[model samples]
Target: MIQASAGRDRIGRTARLGRLRVTKAGQALSEGVLVAVAVVAGVVVAVVAPAGIAVPAAHGAAAVSLLVRARTVAGRVGLRLTLSAISVAAGGLHYVLVDQMGAARHAAGVFPPVVRVLACVGIAACLGGAVAAMVMAATENGTTLIRLRRLLDGWLIAGSLFTVGWVLLLHRADRGGDGSASFLGLGRVVADILVFGLLVALRFCLPHAQRTATTVAVLALAALAAGDVLRILPSEPGAWDGIPLAAAGSLVGLFLVAVAPWLPGGVSVVGFNQRMMPVIGVVAAFVPVVFCALAIAAHTVAGGPIDTVMSALAGSVLLALGVRQGVIHADHLRITHESVVREDHYRTLVDRTSDVITIVSPDERVLYVSPAALWVYGYRPEDLVGARLPLYTHPDDRETLMQAVQILRQDAESDIRGPGRRVSCRVQGADGSWRHVESTINHHPDGLIFISRDVSERVAQQVQLEHLAFHDALTDLPNRALFADRVAHALRKRTTDEAPPVVLFMDLDGFKEVNDSAGHAAGDTVLRHAARRLRASVRAGDTVARLGGDEFAALLEWEAGAPPSSAKEVAERILTALTQPYPIGTMKAEVSASIGMAVAVPGITSDQLLHQADLAMYAAKAAGKGRIRLHHAEPPHAHRGTPNG
Candidate 1:
């Protein structure tokens, strides 16, 4: 029974989850349908609608649809619904107003003064309510009042021009003594213009994310403005009148507005007030110029004094404003040109430098490589961009470079700061040669900047200098200093179970006599030949050095458990090679060697070993030339020598 109950509980939970998913999907579909209806209705009115009862009906339906959709919004629900209701009421009144205007056109006195007044009031209320709703929606989305205040200058300019134009039109109408119908028509036009201006300002004031609904509302207002203008302008007989076009625009605009509540947030109008405002301002500033030209043309054709006087006034105002705008535009161009020049100057400087500059991301990927990389690494900038820094780095040096980069990334993220890090590594160039580079990595918020300079030549020169410091000038072999250093190194590396290193010291028997008999150059040739033979006779790991003129030494490293006789055999080989004839500058010369040997044991220093070998060499010389001797632990009497056989 308990198991059955658990199964029933699981079924119920599963059903509920399914219902929730379905509900979400349904809601999304409904919203999509509403937006589609709004867009279709707006496009129809803009492109194909005729001024008729159908236009008002379409607008009314669209407004009602929007009001219904607004109820679904969670925030400021009551305010949105109220505003939508007022907009709907305004739309309905506008339809009636258009119908009455059409009727009054056919039959005089069909639209009475009271009815006209009521329609005008209703239209005003509708426009006001729609603007208020849009503003409230924007505010609810976190747009501050301070941002709106910044546009006061633009509003003032637009309002002043609108007032002036309206007053001029009214004056002209009064001078002609137009009827009540004309006044009413003028009132409608003025109202439409005012509404259009305010809606435009509101669209500009709202943030981009909150602009979808507002944009639809502005489109609706634009349609109404268009309708008013078309009605005022005369049309050709038997052609499609402005009435149908006006009504169509109004219907489409209102439909779009009504569905705005359900529209997805990403809808954007391409030419918003942010871009259009500057254009509008420039047009507004030149209004006097356009008016002056028209007035002059009118006066020229009609010869009216009033037109001439108006033209003069307009021309004066145009002169002042044109000069001001010209100066502002000139200054703007100057600043822009200077900015471009400065940027180009710095770019050229970076491109011409010898150093290779790179910007890398935190992941060690190269984001940018300067043009100078062509000369420095034999690679174009594009070749290295987006490649990993470690790709071109030597394998042996990557770990060290990565460690430095890791530290740099950490420093960028942490409060601890210092100057950029300097690292030296081998970077493979495009020619497949490894070049030494000294790089300084500077950590920045965006990425790391690596300033690397080629140091291959400098490094090679330094190595050469170091080598020359401890080597023989003539023989190109290790000098006394390097020889002693090697012996000390071998002693320090010696273990208890390993065989100790052996040192062999030797002096040329007849080297000084050759130098006296032959020239010093011939002696040099003999010494060079002997150095090569000595090197050939020893193991590759052994160090052979020339201590001084006619004096030489060798430090031989032996494997553990090798026989002690190995050292004696090496000394005998050196003696045989030394005693052989050497060619000296197209002549034959003869020389021999007396060699002394000592083995490095525990507790024995390099200096002691050298002294013992020197003493043994002297003992070999005393016995006879061309002999080999070994040093013993006791006194000089214990030393052993191999006699001439």
Candidate 2:
């Protein structure tokens, strides 16, 4: 019964996992279908109804489809789709009304005031919808929108100044003309500027991920701008060479807007072609210059003061635009120069530093090595560049270094910001000598930065200090502190079957006489000789220490099943060596040692063992110098110097 239940549980888990995969695939397919339908519809309309009423009708249908599809999307995306649908619908309505008005004007030679008012209303609604779309985009993506807006503002300000200059210059010439036509012309120019500016702004505001939609929208706007320019420049609007261009532009713009809702969302399209911005500014500045030059030419040939005055005003606008462009260019040059100077200054600082700095790629190859490498590691920068990090590391240390690299690489891959890691290892120099170095490694986007400093001198000094802390200065032997520490360590590791370790305490007999007769130097010589003798008498695993003036100690580890007599043999050997004479400089000295031996037992502390051994040494000194005494827990047995001697 349990096995059957387990099999069913396994099946359920597998089914759940499969369901998640299927859902992801289904969502992708749905989006692909929607995109394909939108693109096909746009292509069909563009090819078949380039300048027909069918264009706007097709757009209106697409807009309704978009509004219905928007219900399936959620959150900000749905809101964007809904706004885009409204914009497309308004554009479709404008196209339909304009086409109807054009037909009426063609049939009747003029449109009724009511029809004109309705046409105006449609244009106003279209403009309102475009403005609303821009506002929604800016609110949704604030940073990208603001940047694009700033760039557009610069171009607009320059163009507006030139336009104002021309208007002022041409005002006097238009005084004798029909005032209504002149007003209408001025209003048309202003409206064209506003519409063209909005389209350009929308082009930049669209995200880059919406490539298909953005491309189509840009083409639509460019066609519309070209059509507006044609209408404005030509003297006879109805008889212009490209009369169908304006209608075609309207068709394309409305159709693309209707298709926009079906396009993908959540793709960031914020990148602008920075390289083109300066070219755009230059072109904008040149427009006014060209116009002003034409005005000057006209004045020179025609010889009219009014024409010259108009030329002068136009020339003023061009002069302002050119000056603005020049100012912006000059600012850019200054900033570039300052940036270069700052970079050079920091480069010089890095070169002069004492520590070697290196940049290593993610694959562990060295990308860059600072000039300080020559001084620190006896290697030129070129010698280390492109080399793997483990090449110069000690063979024993390479494994540890690689492990650290793996950890840091994992952290980077996981998007975790870890603290800088520090490692100390041996780095081989050019002269075949290894120098200890301490390196601090920090992670960067392109690679890791290693700031390594030579620490050989520091490491040597640390070793010296540590030795001094635990050893005798004159004899260079472990002191009482270290000796006691070893005893404690052995006690902690002791087991029931193991024989306890032994402690031997020895004191030089009559050592003060050598110091008084031959000076303190001879006394130091005697102590050094005794230390060497004590070390030689013990096993290699034993510890020997100098316990201050005329005093020394030894610790011996006894293996399991070793007899107790072994301790006595070591004590007797130490006594014989210490009793022999020591040569000090030009003089010879003599000293005998009183030795005491104590064996460690369970539940006995290091201090207690040392005290017992000390007591035995005192007893040996009293019983007569140059004797070995074994310590016991009872007073009578503790005084035994040598058994049966």
Candidate 3:
């Protein structure tokens, strides 16, 4: 009930804060009082009719409910006054019209058929309008207004146009019709028609919220009205047919931009879920459906009805349905595309599994190697993918590795090969370190699939195992087994096609004294140093292998121009390398050797050469501790010894 001056403009509201501005309790009392009044009026009329009152007692209760809703919804904004004014005026207007028409018009018993028909038409329009208001509220989704800087001042212009035009029409009317049919009456009718048409045209030309193409449609309607107005005599009222047409077109335009009940249920459902509700779907949907139904019913109630209203509604329904179907199709296509994309993503992940995987041609050439190549050989997956297996095999082992793959590739009849066939050999690494690998091969369609582990650590372990099998663990010079293996390898490399070289075997002299006095720690130091010196003295191609208990041996080949006494030169080199004093903790010790040399003849076997070498070495030891001897050619007795100078 707080009334304040909004502005001087009449459209701008003013509020009154006195007794006239009713409080809620006061308003509620008014409604209750009005309903009571209406009910009493109905009952009184039922018993003894009022000569003046005709609109029913029931309406009084309805007006109270309408006033309560309007006041509650429009609590502070001057909309409360607006709603109150609109609702009360509407209700009061109904009461006045009904009262003047006579109460008997409502009952079948009293009024003539034409009077009853007229009353029925009025009731239907009022009811239709009320129902339409409800739908309109929902479709607007409570969005009564958007914030605007200001309203246009075009209303004055429209009023002026209407006024000036009416005055002109009135003067004409006075000139044509009798002066008794004065300008006043003529001006009033002309003004009413002109006001409606001008407002329609003006609102159209300056479209605000052009919902349902209202502005354009209103202008079209104004044009039709203008045509009819021109046809009418100024003294008479203009025909009213343009009102319905113009209103229908305005509604149609409003329906297009305004959210209407004509849309699908799902549209409303999702619209409700958006963070901000753009449109209230359920409300929008109800508006148009109910609107069409009401219009159809109203038209049918109009004398025998017509196709015009039905056609407008049917066209709207068809357009809405078409738009709905298009949205559904778009959604379906998007889902299908997404599903295919997900499937492709899943497939790619499976193809690049972490396990060491390779595809090979039946011919044993590598077709593809998985990313696990880096894990096995320190090479990128791509480095080995198309490279031949022989490329990764050790130079000494490549011949055999290639042969194995060739066998698989050549065998067209077999599709399966060894699943657990292990080949132990050196594999090449990108860093030039030898990768000790154990490869297991499987025959595939195009080649053999070889999965290998860079068992370098394992190889070092295996070497350790072999060294433990043959040599002293503490010194790691050469295990006896490995010494034996190297001897055998050297012997195997020589044959009738290649002459065998000399084998020199030497055992350290006085190394036991260092161990017994300085401890095994010093003894180990002496042994390791001795091994290093022996390795340094030999040519890069020579084989130096250790025998247990500070015993060592060497192999040297005799080239075409080499000295016939090459063994003497090797003995000298060994002596010189060993003569250097070594530091073992607090003690320094000079170490020497009792060396034995035995030449394997052009076709002599390794067993014969080693036995002769041993006998010569024993002979040199018997001759003197620090000495060298040769045993070969003339059986076991052709022995010679030379003491270091």
Candidate 4:
């Protein structure tokens, strides 16, 4: 009856896992299809129509797509999409008018002002939407104070970039009398720059899944900004051919924005505001100082006096930077205070113990033991006294205790015990448990007096903490730090004749899908299984580690004259092991490993070796997963197979 019930449970779990994998795979396929369709549409438009006609059509299509996306999603993301649609639509109309105006120079004077106004409005809408989206996304679940600080950080970066651009590009003595037209053109350039900066800021504020789309969106803004900047730069008549470039850039930007919402969203940046905001503040504070110094030097060398307006703008930026620093300092103080309080609380919870005193003979036998032996070593004083030190000392540490005894016995004076010497080693308790024991030895006429303390609990706690630092909590595998340290040690011990060590960087395929469909708990189960397989697949002396998330790494050290093919064999085994079905409850989940191996050279550093492996692993992923690639100076060699096992 129990066996049948277990069988049913196993079958049910497998079914659940299969369902989740299929669902995620289907969603991925759908996204790929949509992207393919968008690409084909773009290529067809570009080939069939003229540049001017193609640019506006692209913008119009993108605007419609964004609008549809806005309707599907809600909250800040939707709001940004909606605003972006409007702004893109406006840009398309502006481009159409500009194209028409260019054809009919008779209305050039009138259309210039109208075109400029429309362009400014569109740019303003886009910039505002990007800023609003960033603020809303960043502060959605934050406190009032956090929101305020994020807002401050956003403005500080924006303001600093604006000030730098103005001082370096726009505030010039030569352009003082360039009229309102030139001024408006420069203002447009500055605003476009601001829009690009804000879009970049918004990228970090988004979740990791949304970041790829956000990056595409940022590239779109960069294209548009580049086109706009080119139009206003001083060029000889007919020498500046910006119109075609502008048109092409506009089409690319519009298409990217339109398709961005189609991509999937993943986990948002956790504690982004808390961790990244301060870094942004520090970087923003330095921008004006660096730019202003360069601007001043350039102006002075050109025999131009610094503009008062520019100086005042720089001053204002400095003032804001000062306020930002003050806020960061206050935050640091609060965190430090909380840490101190927590430390005090932990200290209070720790128990105190009195040291154990004993008398040892020159022959390393315990002549007398304190009553504390029962509490310290789980033995009565009578049981411990007159026993040899080797009986209670750990096998591995007995030599250390013996060396200390020799030093104490060989002291020059009988009254002294080798300059107040102390030695620490592991001691065995009566119950067959080991305790970390520290002993201080002193000389006496009859024998040597020893004061020992059992610090097993304290030492155990410290060791556990260190283990946690170096190993992954989920899988108990060595983490990135420990792996890197081992790799460095291996590299240092390499000889000229021996085959160099190999570093394998592995990234799991379809693991994210498992997380997305079955939840993080299921993903963790998959990771634990993967970790075990990885450990078993590698040689006993080789090191295997979880480098975080779905990525893992390994170090393989070879004996002299060992062929590089040895690394390949190990990698294949790992690939086979990891590709096996994982049992999560009753469900069977599957994921494949993409492994990249980099062989070390005489002078190659650990980081470089790791990087090469990373690149090779990415190549394996790109070639198609469930494969291995070996890194070389020229090109990576790839291997793919299906093992019968």
Candidate 5:
């Protein structure tokens, strides 16, 4: 069964790897195809072809290539535009063929109205579709206001260039030609200029990823516009002489537009720099206005003729510039209002928060503190402004706080940015009481920022929990765990020449009798009194603890070069004290104690010493009540004592 499963898994992995390889190979082939198309288009434009058929032949080839590419990319818009180009190319090629056939008979080939109409329609559709696509993309991605601003900027730049072109070049071209032909040529020029302007707007609005495709489309439009402009310039040959240039430009442009959708996907996914849009708009609006003014001034000084057409063109340019400025001013006002509102919202949050925020300089002096400090630290913001941080922190915790600040500084200076440092310390309030505060320190370019919150209540709760874990509830004495810990510590520190530590275990003689006769309340009172007497019997450094119920224990440790007390003497003292009467609510109850004493020896564990003491305690009980027994394997000895306290 395992072999069969493994074979299936291996086959699945092989299939997945094969698919990945095929995908990579397909992408590489597509990129190569685009590069080849671009190179071929470039060569065709640069190399001249036969006069009548060159333009038609170029259009047909370009249209076919564009159609194939657009279909490969599955672009509906691209397909629509390329199909129109195919129709125009077919008409042009048909005319060229017929004209060649007529010239063989030495006859003039009359241009058909149908071919002219197809050419006009094809050009209009291509230019208009491109402009529409840019407008749609911009509107889909940006706000209406932003689109309006971009549109105004585009028109401003395009209108300025159009005015300059008219005043300098096209205005002098012969207007005595066929009126319809002149109008058509003028229409084509205006369309080219308008499409170029829309391209500018599109470039500003799209993100970097999509911008790659937009940039390529912009280059294609620029080429088409250049050819159109050149065709109208005054020349000896007929206007048809510019046909080859326009055709070459169109051939390159169609291929470029087709390759746009196949660009790498990464270009469309990156962020765009929206901040530069305003600067670009300002430059685009002003530079042309200034240049036109200078040119008009020069023309006036030179006594050149300025006609009504020039005046109208200049006025239109000025009008577009005015509208562009208005849009920019409105955008500026909107941004300013938004910034003020955002600032007010953040200010409200800071003022209302409970956490204290402080900014300190590198010299350790506080630079600024938020208003929350008044309640949290009992100091007004102004009072702490110039104060050093260490002065406000508890003396014991000052070094810790300073160390944290140094670590934060190192983190800020390091190449890899580190997270904020958090430290807990005590801070002095205005009332002179120290409060536990947890602070997170972050490095800033100016200095450091400290955000502190009071945690005194939490610390108090934690301390109380720790106390309850290792102390007896009824007597408030150390429990067995705490006593054993101290015994282990003292034993580890003992020297060979010093007195060994002693462990004493005691059990009450009459505790159960009191509980049965006077109830558990009286027994508790007796236990409390016994614990107190046991503490008084031992030295201050020794540990006295309640093991549980009526049982008790004590650890006697001696200091170096000090008077040492005998373990037997301490046990007798405890026995005498425990035999004393305990007052319980206006009555008296008496209890007797039997104590066992064990002296520590070399290599003895705390538990082993405790067990030995326990065994001695049984021996004391066996010797009768109110007796102290010493733990020894050689001889059994007991000290019978009477109540002395």
Candidate 6:
């Protein structure tokens, strides 16, 4: 980026500009300084010291820095403009003072031709400046560009007029109606005027790519025309000025080529033409340029007001035709407005009222999104508009979400509302960022209404809720309800092919003894350590449940064996793992599990399994403390002496 001070601005905005670097400041001061110089030089030359007239040139030289500084405030494009205007004034001074007014001192090597040379140089600079302005304007806003374009055309017209007027003055001075430089100059002037008009027409009609080419071609033809006019004229002192003017014009054309892309296509003029329009419109400019060149050639040779009048009249005709076309399209405009308004109003209600409103059509187009889209998901209404709504839906939840919507849409056929479905999705924003969102969709009488929210936080909260409901808060193991549920599911299976599942009921054998010897805190540690051992000892497919204080249950799926064998095998695994001493906070303590197992009967309830396991567990405790036991048909010989409950 250029220094802040180094860009374009108009008079009104110039004060708004802050400071900028020197290079960007180079555009405006030159000609305005020359203007002040000329007024003084003209008067001074006419008075006492004609030789001292070189002061004006010195002053003009000094003004360059000032102009550049001014341009910096205005920016590159605006600064170019001020330069162009100043150049035009310089060219006019050349015509009036050197050609007509007897302004410059005629002495030494400097001579009066110095003024003419300055004029030629000014014309060249002005043309370069205008081209630069146009290119910068191209990248600017429509409002800024439109005015810049008009100014460019006007500046070009001035160049042509000055060239034509200069020749006419020369003809008058030489006392020859000599059908020479004057007529050639008139032809060039008319041709340049035509070129200017054609440019304006092409600008509106053609695209940017074509405009660039057409601009070059028209400028080339203009140079050739100037050459033809100037070549025919004869001058007294040196080679004629006309040809050099034609050369200046050629250089001007080259300058335009350098500057054109920077105009509307550059940083300034945004939204000047839609991207596609510029691509196509450029090609169309050539045809108009050719016709205009031809008209100028014809106008130049014919030597009448007919060409000028015809061009003006044609512009009027086009204006009138455009007015008529507007009248014809008025009804279409009304219809377009009505359709858009209806849709907009419907969308507006959804945008305002809902936390996240989405109107998804049956066909899958995202017809509308709400204002809450911004808060719920970092997306604007436009980003989702026409994007498929379901594309954002989480893949794992899609089937369930779609199924629910389908059912609702079907219900709408009867009642306009089915059971609502919650779908979790993510929405992408205009900035290409995403946010997690959940939506509840309903089929409205017209189409569909979806209310959505950013539920990422809520989803985390729900996960915590589910965890609390099913697990031990401290040890993070399955609680009694979950443990019972696992056993219940295992027992509920009606296994016709394989063995029934086994349940292992466990009580930490030495837990109370440890609690009495150690602190209550130490006892809690033993309970937690025992749970961990039970969990680690069991297979991944087995369920390890903490059944309140000091008691635990495990459900094991039977593979190819009877339930008693697998139950005994798993109980042994738990007992072995629990024997490893646990470091309870400060002290190490050893413990064992007194486990009872039940190989479930087919179609038996979970409560039956629990009762049998409890009975077996008590028997194991009596038999030896840590070894597992199985339920016998009635009772073991050792337990035969015991009373029935």
lDDT of 2 by residue, 172-279 (tens): 324523333333333323333444444444454444445445445445454544443433344433423533554444444555555544555332232333323444
lDDT on C-alpha atoms for all candidate structures: 0.68, 0.65, 0.50, 0.69, 0.68, 0.55
What is the TM-score of candidate 2? Answer: 0.55
* Full-model lDDT, candidate 1: 0.68
- lDDT of each residue in 210-324, candidate 6, tens digit only: 4443354345335434433443344431233322343333233323322333233212322243322344343343344344445545656878344344555445434433443
Among all candidates shown, the one with the greatest TM-score: 5
Total clashes in model 2, counting residue pairs 3 or more apart in sequence or in different chains: 2
Ranking by lDDT: 4, 5, 1, 2, 6, 3
Best by lDDT: 4
Better of 2 and 6 by lDDT: 2
Candidate 4, backbone clash total: 5
Model 3: lowest-lDDT 10 consecutive positions: 144-153
Q: Name the candidate, 4 or 6, with the larger lDDT value.
A: 4
Q: How many residue pairs clash in model 1?
A: 3
* Model 5: per-residue Cα lDDT over 395-426, one tens digit each: 88887788777656654554224577788999
Give the TM-scores of the predictions, in the order they appear. Answer: 0.50, 0.55, 0.36, 0.44, 0.66, 0.41
Model 6: runs farther than 4 Å from truth?
1-354, 378-381, 399-438, 442-446, 561-564, 633-645
Q: Mind giving the per-residue lDDT tens digits that candidate 3 earns over 168-285?
A: 4433655633332233223323333333332332222221223222332233234323432442334333324333222222222222212111111201211011112123322333
Q: What's the TM for model 1?
A: 0.50
Q: After superposition, how far is residue 495 of candidate 5 from its true place, in Å?
A: 7.1
State residue 600's C-alpha deviation in candidate 6, in Å.
1.2
Candidate number with the higher TM-score (3 or 5): 5
Which scores better on TM-score, 1 or 6?
Answer: 1
Of candidates 3 and 1, the better by TM-score: 1
Candidate number that wins on TM-score, 2 or 3: 2
